[model samples]
Target: MGWGWLSYSYWFPRVHSQNVPNSALFYPAVDTDVTPCHYRIPAVYSFGSYLFAFCEQRLDTSKDYGRMNIGLRKLCLKDLGRCEDDSEWSKFCQLPLLEGYRTMNPCPVGCKETGKLYVFVSAINAKIHEAEILKGRNTEDFKLFVTSTIDCGESWTPWQDITYNFNENVPVGSKFVVLGPGHGIELHSGRLVVPGYFYRMPSSFTEEILRQMPNGRKSPPYNNVGCSFCLISDDKGETWNISTTSDNFTYCVVDNMYRHMGECTIAETVPGKLLLNSREYGNGQYRILAESEDGGTSWKQGKVCTQLRDPTNRGCKGGLAKLVLEDVRYLIASNCGHPSARKNLTLWISQDDGATWSKPWTVRDRELCGYSDIDTYMDPSTGTAYVAVLYETGVSSYSERIDFISIKFSEVLEKCSY
Candidate 1:
């Protein structure tokens, strides 16, 4: 891609050129003090027709280098769309962010079958890295916290630990897949899909470091990676089959040009096909994409759609929002912000299930980007799309807050112009 902007490559499908700038950008607003760069975001539909934003609030004191926490918020759709003159266009009410986050991860999805929004967040009480500098902390506290809402976002219940055994393992990608919501929907034959993964800590740091991480050392043979397996459930996420390794896929590539497969989100397209989006950090760059037609148990491969490239902006977590606007099935992915320059947020589309894609547009182009995760819902009856993005505003991870890019898919792809 060229600097500032590059003309749509010939490799791109031929389509009319249009500029759609969302209204939400007009008066971007901030809600809380991130303290030390907070941006891994995920959002789902609100009962009130609004959007709920999620992210981790990291607080690292000079003396305490590895300390971190996560939080959530409730925001209106038009707020991120920047559609109105009302001050609420970008306002957020911080919910009781999880306490003692230390090392907590959160992701959410709405299940139309159950009519309740559920979240599969990573919960850890303590994490101890073998590096002499990384000991004494609680290195054994990570569980998935599932919360939900029935009456819009008017209220929320305490987190319910869906994890079967603290030691057995957990199945989580960047976030869990939503077969439906509330209890989740079952197939006609009485089958259901709930995707998650478990991580294996290192046996010892890999030299230079006290104990090598199981996957690899902190620095790596420069390359240390492994895959988490999925734990399936047929009874609406109540009971799960044994965890299984995703056999169809492999770890990310590490060329002199690329680094690793960062964090990610998964989606089910068509009937059995699944798509994965990830955040990679290394070589001072970021890229994302993973696809599987076998129900996320494994995949076909990874596609580095250049259009999804955000040079300097560090992308975080993101989701898939499907739409058949003008006879095309589009999946818009976001990285909150790329580590590269002028490139922050993006919305990409894939016509062939999740196999291939067309050029995507940039949205929520904020400079300070962190864990950028998104989830969208379409009024099945109206085809009105509502997308929510989690992003930071300041200049770096040190300055952050939880804000969303709330807008209708039509308003974004058809009406708004950048």
Candidate 2:
């Protein structure tokens, strides 16, 4: 139990079935502890049978860094384990410019022939670690905000400033960064790979994503730590351009070795053979997949899943949510554990699609501190499997708060297909 203890109480992680084949967990009498679905960078989407937990209701301390205040909650997919009656749950603070501050990191997807649910969030205002160090200093005034929800979570419609010009005349780069996995695939020519991500901020980075330098800080750090593009929204997510990757990876620092591409998520395997699976935090750690047949623009240089472990030994900037159940392939990621240990919060699975990965269990072990997140979904008509995690037990010095867990993959595959 290395750096364990998620504090508070109610814990769950019991899925070994018989001999542990599809091994899964969380059944502490049906999981459920403390929760508003917590947030330290959260985003979960399960649509339909219901499993949507968006975060960052983190009011302000200048913003993002001030942390916690962006809100939206809805749970009822088997109550995710235990505890219920939060007086009949109902939350909504649909980004009123994140009043009081702290936006979030959401990427909801569900377009099954237009069941309608397209959420791609990243609406910021500063403070979240200085909005990634002011997009590495100046990303055209660093202010990110993108919102949409065509009905599935009830209602939410304002805010959608993606700008998305992409011709590069003066686009300053930075948007989406990556929000894959929601199924659109028609491509053989129909065109529809809205996999999102194009970061490289600091042309004055703020003023709510200022269009073209309302005060884009006057442009400075060319590529401090950016570069991740690919946007082709031909009428699904409603329009986007720059289908980059001919040579568009504009931010890299070799020899001394530095890389870019944060918050990625893609999983489509048969149409044009797409597999992107991403999550790499600069300098180097692991969890790369990269393989865009003709869809993600271009990418084919990452095949390391090292059983998933990178608790910040100088690396840990989390984001990775995948799903594929039945054919297997599941992933809900978090960093700061292996050595960097943000107090244990890792989860993994892959019947094969990330090539090779296994043995990364534990929703949030529980010892004494807190900070947790995760999300998963697989329901191509009813294979039924949805996981949503949120744990934050007592802040540093010992005491904060947030806990809510849910897991159901046929009840851990009927107790591990044993």
Candidate 3:
């Protein structure tokens, strides 16, 4: 595992060893402005002739708890798979939220077949923090809301609360669910798959057990039992269902290494097959990988991808995109490459679905890097396909700003020497 990159390069040599610059690098796509806040958790998707980008506009503070809203910008596609300057994306607007609730985790999915775009977010009570809910000290009033657009970000439908329908099918002990902090996918079969995970209350802890337990055990130990599942919609984004697969479920152990899996993203490898990449709630430094055989309804056991290294203690959220060129499919991922620090942002290419990966190509070598989302698009005129990345990065703090970058598929293959 330690020499995974070296072994991959040995098998596939590059014809051109020189560095080929990226197509475009748009810095500060979302930045802290007048009020002094933050823009984090970037999600990008190619819809229509524009690139739809979204992120969390954390007002007052960058902390997870507080006033937050989803901000979006539609970038115009230009020649060679590049987009117009960030300044030209003047349609920057913030979505409306329910009173006393903060909307977050902007997971956008677009259906080319229907020409509809949906953004799914979690509306949480502003007074409650995630820690309080995880520790069982406060029950979070979490609701699911989704809004759609048909005119390419010109206007959006009113927020429709779908909490009841989604909750009714969730597991009995489910605490709450978190949507993709990135983007979702519309499968070839017209299935809308949104990757997410939720925490569940441990059934072993009862009143009798609490009474006999010690002081440390008497207090609600953080409910670390979690399962990664997909929010599936068979008829476009009209209705949804939850997957009850047990393979990706995990409970906290004595070492606290196998905690909850959350902030997941999904990509369809082939027809009816999907790959899920998730962030860990514990100290595991490797990203958890799982596969679904039946279009994200059920998943195989979640295992650590030794090649995909992440920082310990709540692994950072990464992005995954599926690309095909010359009838060959490749899975591209982006995240902070350093094992201990949120720096060294890099891109990895997986030739065999996800079984093996090529050596990483450094994106940002020495700066704070955070959550990222990846999607591929083609130039409307030239038909040149490209891989786009929207990620959080800063010199001092990872959440200080969000940046966007794009590179041609041919150049990516050359740069990574895959």
- The TM-scores, one per candidate, come to 0.65, 0.28, 0.85
- C-alpha lDDT of residue 266 in model 1: 59
How many steric overlaps are in each model, in order?
Answer: 56, 51, 0
Q: Number of the top candidate by TM-score?
A: 3
The TM-score ranking, best first, is 3, 1, 2
Full candidate order by lDDT, most accurate first = 3, 2, 1
- Model 2, 1-115: lDDT tens per residue? 7435743121222223121111111111112432323334445555566666555444333223555444556656544443343433444444445453344555555555556
lDDT of 3 by residue, 1-418 (tens): 5878865246433223332233223233334343666788889888778888898888868888889888887777763255434555644578766688889999998888889999999878888787776665555478788999888878899999878776556766677677888889988898998888777665543454234333433212264456678888888788876755544333233322334577788899999989888876666777888888888877776777877777776778999999887889999988777776676677788999998877777766666678888999888778788988888877678887777777787777776655
TM-score of 1: 0.65
Candidate whose lDDT is highest: 3
Q: Give residue 111's error in model 2 in angstroms.
A: 10
